[model samples]
Target: MAEVIKSLNLLESLKESIEKNNISDIKDAVEDMLISRINIALVGERGGEKAAFINSLRGLGVGNEGAALCPSSAAPDELAVFPNPKHPDFRLWDLPAIPSNTPFDPENYLERYKIIRYNSIIMTFTQNSSSNMVAVWREARSLQKDVYFALLASDKDTEKTLEAKKKASLEVLKAEGVSQPKVLLVCPTALEKLEFLMLLEVMLGDLPEIRAHALLLALPTFSSTLVAKKKEAFKALGWAAASLSAGVSAIPVPLVASMVDASIAVRILTKAQISLCLDDESVERLARQRGMDPTKLKGLRTCLLSVEISKSEVKRRLSVAEKDTSTATTKLVELAMPRHARSVSRSFTVMLQAINSAIDDMSADADKIIAVATGVSQ
Candidate 1:
């Protein structure tokens, strides 16, 4: 049987760090649950496939119910935002396209939209790169926005046509004195088929670690690689939550130490659920796109999502894991493992194991949902 490991003093130290809520360490994990995001502006001419690219970037399709749409394409006021907007922090605004010859001046248009500046700019274009597109590039350049050029060619464009268009756009940028500009020719809906998405990550390389993490969390996960990345991120958070629980254990909680387990379990899972887009609303949105009932689609998961996992369930799982581990430890008395050294230590061990196990299960749960979203069997 696994005996209670005691180390109250150690738990005290860890709690101090967690209560600080500093996100400097990758291992500091829990703070990621409340990460804020920077703005990413998608600006270009109308036919640049900007909206489609945004959907693809977010791993959504035209048929995907949760996909963001252009104002002209859909009435913004009609959209469902009962609980909250998806990717609320990372705003991906679809700006009005500029006419080559228009009464609306570039500077005036920007002011009207209140787009003073952005963290990054996705400057999209096609074969005939007009001054309107160039105007956006110049404005973004003047504002010092991190701009990425994408030569968008949909499925309708011929391969030869795509190549010719790409070459022509590059020459335009060169003529404008933008030397060796990083340009991508991509089928907006098919991200992995080209290096555009990879280069996009490279573009975000300069952001701070925490900011970069927030962007990644907000990014669309269409592939296994992105899923794995999000999984590890959520896993990292478990330790911080475990640490938080250790702190709770140290506090005199009206004679109920189990309260710590319940509180931490629920809160941590809630954070992960929102971050991973596993909440009920997000699930419903995805299911609507797939033409499946939300509850039915969610039924495929082996583990509970944040909303589905109850406080009592958290306590129950923690109790079971501790009891099971303790029983197993009792049988391994030959090794004489030091599990009981301090009150907090024993409590911390139990909480850590429980939280880590929950995180792993949550990750798997998220994977199953992703599979459904990507048309793969769970």
Candidate 2:
């Protein structure tokens, strides 16, 4: 009896360990399997608009140069898999609908077509009054574990009509105890309604858990030419400051010039108002209309101001020019004034000066912020 108890205790301990540790390991292994081989299958009735719906999900069209999948019209009972551009691990299968008055054995159909291997099923429907659709949904729910319903309703139909159809379909799914099915509505012909289809692609492409976690975490920083320009300017400023601190006699003129040029380019690109409104023609026109002699204006131009100025400075310059309209030509000059040119020049000089004095201060503040963010630096 004592030997029996000892053996039983050992078995219990092993079971407990498995329940605590092995269960998580098993779940992780299963999830990895699903992630590696998960396939999304689209199934609907013949001539039911499933092909067009699949094309939209794949960001393709019938006659487009880059089609994700070329669907056949004659073969109503065919299946096609859309190519994934971003993720090649999973497959997207497009299955033709079952014919009407065909064998109604759901288990046999699923097994015959090997539909049970799919990770998710997208059932398409044109109308809510489809009896075959209800049967398919019922069968799918019984056999397939994860299923989503997508309604390819007509775009020309009134909003009331679409809403009624959607509600009816939702009710049917609810009646079968299918809770919170991921529903997507597509209007193949309507270009305006393509956003929903694109959203559906993103949702299906991302793992559910990853998508959920993304909502809580900060979004990935987008790096553009503008961002690169800013980083370059920051680095340049640091270098200039370091050079000045070491009592370097001559600054690298080319390096400084390049930094200034890049900074000006970035500033010009970002300022929509200045970039668009004040071109060379506009400046010339203002000078011509204001009757301010272009020669006199050119003579007045002293130094190419050190750097670009702020938006406030541009506005102020415009305001000053507007107020100083002693001559019609001057007034036109006010209207056509290169507000950005002066500000940009001034900012460049100010930034260069700041590089020397405030480098340590700026770097320290940036480091503190980075430290507080717990290794997250932008």
Candidate 3:
């Protein structure tokens, strides 16, 4: 309940910030969201696990060009950056090996890579935490940066095991003054942890609400819970999108009936498709992963964002809907957007129906995908 209230407050705060167009208040948020650049540095001991984890985040196979560099021995003491193959905006940077012989300098190390400048940090561990890692963790926290603790517990285990690992990590971190270290026992490739989703939630905290909203929309759709979060993230966007449609189409023409800005509508729907990873390519990849035909998967797009509907097609649907002698759609739109909708309200109705209908369709599509992936019918 508190979380829900917090979320609502943040959403409203962010919207207010954006609406007022206060440059300083929103410059970082706008830059982060618009550029879609989220820098997360993996700082830890040299090992293949962290490297493999980085690759898994990219969704690439073992031999792919941008594959996570998994070295049997210590990888060199240099930073390696990997762009998310699916999401160009998401980046993973692997910090250099921890020097065993020399005295570790957190300030110099952080400065050398400018890791201090990254949006987030993940200190990866398998066996146990190290002093150098603890040093970096304290340094990052001291600098007021978001730092997460990740444990590569790839092998499926009981919830008991997850909690035990998290508890131990928490105890160690508490001594270092980290009261609550968000720990994720995630298998990077499979993404099999509720805690992983929780970790993402943690990362969004203190960020501008709109920036958080953008990150939620742009995140790679991984879990059903994540899909739900994405939906909530987009709920407020519907009105803005509808307004854009209405605003763009308010030309001085004869009132022939309801009208919609097809171009704006198309752009909105296209962005939703891309943001939700429901485009042709993403759907195909998902299908292949499930050993199913991509053709069969087209019907799997129950989520409006995931559905493969184009702008022209959406426009056609809206046009048909406007003349369909259908008062039910018209009434629904009327009820949804009645405030200050006097002159161009009819056009608002057209857009409201178009977007609302897409939301319904794409939500179902998301359900289908989750059902297939989780083997639990929605």
Candidate 4:
């Protein structure tokens, strides 16, 4: 497809810029991949369920840093924003709940919360508030905003009760003039379930391709399936990191290229490790939330970078790469060549190998952690 070619060309252009040692262009390209803004509004009641859902989506716990503040009761006039701890560019806005007893004003709701700026508006409805939610949905629809409905289900909810709740929501929407209604039933306490994945798939389908990719990378690894998907997305990032590494290590000073390669690998792999939730913070939080000992859970991580991502460790990996003379040159090395041709070529190849191996190991560790957290067999 032409679009695919354009995408590939854009990456090639970035590689060219990096090869030219354009530091500003390299930073901008890397920033575009890591810090693209994505705003999603969760229009729902101020309660534990919504808070937990927000935290789960952002891959945080109720009390963790950057987690959504869980309110004790519902407030229909408050707006709280929570940034993803790992990816601050992706924000979750908790908008005011729809009033069940009063006449709801869609215009004021839309303007007061600045709903127009949101990439997507998710109206989370309880059993009794679908009517007001439908009112807001109609307005959001008119503005051509991506909108969705969700109903929180608890562990106590039986199949029949959940179906009844979903049916009741659809009936309310139908009465309010919506031709067809779909309410996603999500368990806020457990986001790795089938329903939540379905909801995520629908949302991703509607998002622009680039934004969808950003969202996919920003989201926490909730399941093995998600880990696998993230692994594929991170491959492109791996190449980008390698190009940047090669650009920075173009210096001709003896041993400078090797040292610079190790440093760049550490920086890139550290970010990758954190994004995969292989960091000590995420592991400890998971252990605390699941009532397990943190040390034991940390012991389960298999990736070298997962254990530690430092210059010394990365240098060791680079040494291993150098010793393994049979390393295959990747497209990244071919596409991006620096000033010191020979030194940069070898350094880039070693960095690429280390980065590729690190990404694979981190992804596997992420999947293992998710399996343990969800009690699912890998």
Candidate with the greatest lDDT versus the true structure: 4
Q: How accurate locally, in lDDT, is each candidate?
A: 0.60, 0.41, 0.61, 0.74
TM-score to native of every candidate shown:
0.69, 0.40, 0.76, 0.82
Per-residue lDDT of candidate 1, residues 215-245 (tens digit): 7677655556666666665544454455555
Instruction: List clash counts for every candidate, in order.
Output: 17, 16, 11, 0
Tens-place lDDT per residue, model 3, 1-378, is 123324444334333443443324433432333345667788766565676677656545455566775572334777777787666777778887555454878788778878766878888776555666778778777888877888766455456776787778777777766655566776655654445676677777755565566556665666677777766545445544444444433445554223336655565566567666677876666666557778876777655446565665787767764655247545544433434443555665566566656765675676576577656666
What digit string (tens of lDDT, one per residue) describes model 4 on residues 305-331? 887787877787778877773434544
Better of 2 and 4 by lDDT: 4
Clashes of 1: 17
Ranking by TM-score: 4, 3, 1, 2
Where in model 4 is the C-alpha error above 4 Å? 1-10, 15-23, 62-75, 100-103, 174-180, 208-210, 246-260, 322-348
Q: Alpha-carbon error at 47 in model 3, in Å?
A: 4.1
Worst 10 residues of 3 by lDDT: 22-31
- Evaluate model 3: give its lDDT: 0.61
Error of 3 at 371 (Å): 1.6
| Cα RMSD of predicted structure 2 | 22.5
